[model samples]
Target: MNQVIELIQSHRSIRKYKDTPLTNEQVETIIQSAQMASSSNHMQAYSVIGVTDPNVKKRLAILAGNQVYVERCPLFLVWCADLHRLKVACSLQDTEMVAGTTENFIVATVDTALAAQNAAIAAESMGLGIVYIGGIRNNPKEVAKLLHLPELVYPVFGMCVGMPDHDPGQRPRLPLELIYHENRYDPEKAKKGIEEYDQMMRRYYLNRTHHSRDTTWSKEMAAIMRQPNRKHLRSFLEGQGFRLE
Candidate 1:
């Protein structure tokens, strides 16, 4: 395949990063790449916070379930879904912006994710490694307070970017049939695909962990689905001025 496709397919989450920090030019290029991502109506309802302060990173690491990578990485970027700027624009025109419909919330969140993925690609292309830290959502309120986020803004996720100290092989994805459909979704196709992928993953995990962790993807997914994850998210979002209505 082409270089771009090869680059994309070879993606891996780099948890262990070297102490080497990114240069100012590298940071600018990555952020500029992120800004070029397509946005819904060009609203661009998002913002990113780049943290280099050791003290702040240490506290963030603790807040994010003690993910040491958060503190260890030279650059930690918090990607936020933001509508506060839109509100300001509305106010400038003497229009009271409708702050938090569910649609608006989805748009902002998707926009943030899109921008972040672009940043990831840019970083990877530049020979840097990155990993997304969803753990930041574990303590959204404290994170928001620490970040000094305003209303109509919430942290969607954080990213750790630096030189990779080690290579963790890429994880296998589910069978294509399970995710991609022709036109109408075929339940039978999905079922068969999952069954096939489970066996593939079973072997993969066993091989990867020296037979210490012999589990299938479906089982892991079932365990995750059984528990209510981050039930506090609703209240936190509401408090952050996202009506979710």
Candidate 2:
């Protein structure tokens, strides 16, 4: 495979990091690469907050379900889906801005995710390790308070990046046959593939090093579905001034 494809396939969520810190130049380079990502209608409705303060990171770690990596990682980046800037633009043009629409919120969230993926790829290319921290959403309100976020802006997720202290195998993905469709939806074929993949994942989980779990993909998903996961997100978004209409 080509270098680009190989790099993409080598992705792993690295949790442990070395004590070394990334230089400002390297951080800026990754941010610049993220800036190159496509934005919906060229709105660029997103921003990133790089936290280097140990005290703040420690607080964030507690807020993010006691994930120590947030505090220990050399650099922690909080990706925010922002519509406030568009409001500012509308004000400058003497026009009323409709920032509460669900479409705008969706667009801003997508833009933030795409930009973060770009930054992740850039960081990996530079021999750094990174992991996306969705736990940041567990306490979105408090996180916003800690970060001093204004209305029409919210943290979708955070990322921890630093030198690798350990190497982890990439998690397995569902088969291409199950995920990829030709012309239309093929539920039967997808179901068959998933049945076989469930067994495959059963073996994977049992064989994985350290903290091996006795579960299959379907079983794990079922368990997760049975539990409430960020069900308050809609209310939190509403509190942030997103009408989500």
Candidate 3:
């Protein structure tokens, strides 16, 4: 297998890190890898802000559902889905842009996520560890305030990057048979696969994390669906100027 393939296969979310700092060259290399990712229509509607200040890291940690790793990592990068620059350009020319629409928002978000994943893969190839913090969405408005983001921009997610001080066991994923379908979709086959994978995930999590009881993946997912934790996401997105319709 190619080196990148091997890296991709072995990738895991790392939460611990050594106190070592990344060299300037290594940082630049990772950023360049992110920049090289394919953009939707070559709009490049994204930006990455590297946060190094201790105070800022602490605030981000609090905002990110108290994920302490955000403060511990040597480098914290907040990737943004940005249409602000293009909007400003158009405005300067006395033109109107429809970047505030739902379609444009989806494109920018997808573009940012693709670039961030590329950066993650590149870092893993170089023996660096990384984790993506989705909790940046927990308080999007506050996060935007903290980042000083302008209108037409939203923080897609935050990434913590550093050399590993500890190697956590790889988390199990659903079997390929469950996820990949052939020409036709088979609900029964997929359900069976999920059942088997849920058992495997229970064992994996019980052995890996701090939880006392084994929680099957299907059960957890079902519970989340029932809880409606993210029911406000649509309203939040609308408040951020993203028109879902």
Cα lDDT of model 3 by residue, 109-157, tens digit: 9999999999999898889999999998888888889999887788889
lDDT-best of 1 and 3: 1
Q: Model 2 reaches what TM-score against the true structure?
A: 0.97
lDDT for every model?
0.95, 0.93, 0.88
TM-score for each model = 0.98, 0.97, 0.94
RMSD of each: 0.8, 1.2, 1.7
Candidate 2 least-lDDT 10 residues: 205-214
Choose the strongest candidate by TM-score: 1
Tell me which residue pairs clash in candidate 3: none
lDDT of 2: 0.93
Give the residue spans of candidate 2 off by over 4 A.
210-212
Candidate 2 lDDT over 1-245, as tens digits, reads 99988888999999999989899899999999999999999999999999999999999999999999999999999999999999999999999898889899999999999999999999999999899999999999999999999999999999999999998877889998888889998888966788899988888887784446878898888888988899989999999999988
* Candidate ranking (TM-score, best to worst): 1, 2, 3
For candidate 1, write residues 34-87 as lDDT tens digits: 999999999999999999999999999999999999999999999999999999
| Order of quality (lDDT) | 1, 2, 3
